[model samples]
Target: MNLSHPHSSGTIVRCRRLLEPALREVVSGLHPWGARMVAFAMGWAGLDGREQDADGGKGLRPAITMLSAEAVGGTAEDALPAAVAVELVHAFSLAHDDIIDRDELRRHRATLWKAYGVGPALLTGDALLALAVSRLAARPEAMPYLSAALIELVQGQTADMAFENRPWSGPDVVTIEEYAEMAAGKTGGLLGAAAATGVALGGAPELADRMWTMGRDLGVAFQIVDDVLGIWGDPRLTGKPVHNDLRRDKKTLPVLAALASGGPAARELAAVLATGAADEESVRRAAHLVEEAGGREKARALADRYLDSALGVLDECLPEATELRDVCHSLVDRVS
Candidate 1:
């Protein structure tokens, strides 16, 4: 993290403390029991699914749901069930992501796929998905929206996987569109679902549309920042390759925009991406391209843009939950 962001640590601690327990309750007690049971399916036994889910990263989606609910004049207690539903989906996504990416680490530990292999990982993810449905069914009133959200989540993952199978990179026109679509699924879709669910849980059907838009924008901003850190962040902090995104030819917002710059950086980025599945040498070379192409500055600007827009929606649509305004801002400003 930039030393300049003095208050980031405190804010992260505060937010996590406020959110962690609530997440635990929902998952442990069955936020959506159907989904948790899915996590426990026979296939999951081969993969250590329960352990991974239990020891996963921050429960951001569910926390966001609870915060949104509270910000909208609803109680955290009322939002707990929905929170569980949101998190079950998130955990399943992560497990699958590990397999698809062939990644070994998550939350600084061996990813499910790494420990159990792709087959078990797939089974684990499937169980969790089924459990999510079960949890939604438990809340008959919320089932329709919850189930729809889960479907959307799957669609997003599908799009993401489809893009990874393609061979291309950098800010070429096709690459840009593909990257955006991939991100929309892998990132934005879930946030949209969570926000929409929050509105539904709060009995604010009229506001679900607005909240969905806000959440989508927030997801975009969140992803942009993540890409930045994936490239330039502290290795000690993020625990991944310094430029993992670059190595994957990720075509992230910054890299794309930089490629769009049509500068020397763009040329280098294009060249490196043109040779996909890079090694450490090539990854460093591609990052140099990002810097040369003005990617860093552009990524920051794009992230700020969506964040600002989301904040605007929050102000207009969630006036009752004014505290969330500050909290969400902190999410953007904080360096992970």
Candidate 2:
């Protein structure tokens, strides 16, 4: 689970090197104002337009894209367009997600909307998405997956936002099954597209469907791990305030699983959540109850299950892709 293991790290670094120039070239097509905003969003520069070594992201999506191509006997360069497209889509999603969630911090810094105005940030997100689409507009083999991802992403985001209005318990409560579907869409779609497009562009078009399914399962696992971290991870690493999800009433997997236990601790946790208070002590207590009710353990088990499912597909389709497997494993095992 060492994400920085030499092999996987080398793969990521190599893919990133290939992706950066192309990403920069595409982003450079924007107007200066939009370009500056995008540069900030991509962590290439600070709000002052000075370059800073910020946490851009793991570049995992693009890495996955390139590796999928390589796994199928195609050079990483063959999937470069797909890699860059997924990365831009990722950035676009984050820019809009921050605005939708009203989250001010991301990757240990101010979010795009926080640094820039919401209107500009929204437009910048649109611009990034447009560039992403343009990258593969002529690639009929890969474009369909990206298009489907956009649809799924929107559907998932809408469902997640709608969940906020649902009851915390009883018949109308958001179920685990529902959460899985949402995660598969919101978080998994782009990952799926990355793999699908990779295989498609890599001359293994027939394997694209299976890889898409693999990425979706991986996405669910990734999202569940993210839920676990949002509640318990150190802010220094996660770059998010403790209990921020709880404070926002986010329908996270851990909290939902905890409330479903139907035990004493679960009952207590329900009462705490029903209070609708976001006080530090309350949220801390809620987090403790989630762990006490075995929510964290359930979440971990579920993540492992999904990760295993994804790896099973990888094994069947591309057994030689050891580095790609490691990267996928690292996604669920990541601390940040």
Candidate 3:
């Protein structure tokens, strides 16, 4: 289940080999300054505009696009546009997300907004989105899904931001159902677009809807795992300060679930959270209480269920897509 499973790694390598040239070609069209900023955001270069080895991201979204295409018996080239589009959108989201969250780090480096000014970083995110739209401008079969995903992504982000003001325990508190809906929109939408566009461009437009649903389900699972990591994952591996999400008062799944447990640990965790886990001691205590209240275990179980649902769609729709299935499974299984 490790993300480094040979099959998954090989698939990623093959997909990236086909993806890089196309991505660069599109990015090259940007103004020099814009391109340089993008290079930094993509881990292709440093803030000084010199190329450097940095962790951009896992390129999971694009990998899914290409694999989904191949799964449907189409060539990787058929999915290239969609792959590039999804990756660009992924970068765009990150640039904006860092600003929204006021996060200073990403991929073990300064975030786009941190390295550059917020205004420039925001514009860079907009530029990325523009490029993403341009990639599909000529393809009506796939454009709508990407557009829909953009809308959903915005809605989900708004909901997440709104959750910050709600009390930790009350009728107005964010629920698991609400969290899943937000996750589906915020994280799932673009993933859904990737799969939908992949299948649509790959020659099986009829299967796009099912694949979109599958990706959304997968997204929920992926988001839940991310919530776990945001609280408990190693800063070295995650490339950000641990417990940053909690300090920001983000309504992550683990915290929400822990509070719902109604146990002594959950109560203590809730009290600590209500005080605003701004200090290191409180954040650490809250993390431990979340785990002690069974939040971590419950989150994992829920993630498994959603992943299973996604896999089931793949099973019924594209039974021959073993590589795609493995890659999707590895996403939720990733440790960092």
- Stretches off by above 4 angstroms in model 1 are 1-55, 138-141, 165-172, 175-178
TM-score of each candidate structure, all chains considered together: 0.81, 0.98, 0.98
Between candidates 1 and 2, which one is better according to lDDT? Answer: 2
Alpha-carbon lDDT, every model: 0.66, 0.91, 0.91
Residue 281 in model 2: shift from native, Å? 0.7
Worst 10 residues of 1 by lDDT: 39-48
Off by over 4 Å in 3: 1-6
Q: Could you tell me how far off, in angstroms, the CA of residue 35 lies in candidate 3 after the best superposition?
A: 0.7
| Cα lDDT tens digits for candidate 2, 3-87 | 6344577777788888998999999989999999999999899999998868898699999999999999998899999999999
Q: Which stretches of candidate 2 lie over 4 Å from their true place?
A: 1-7
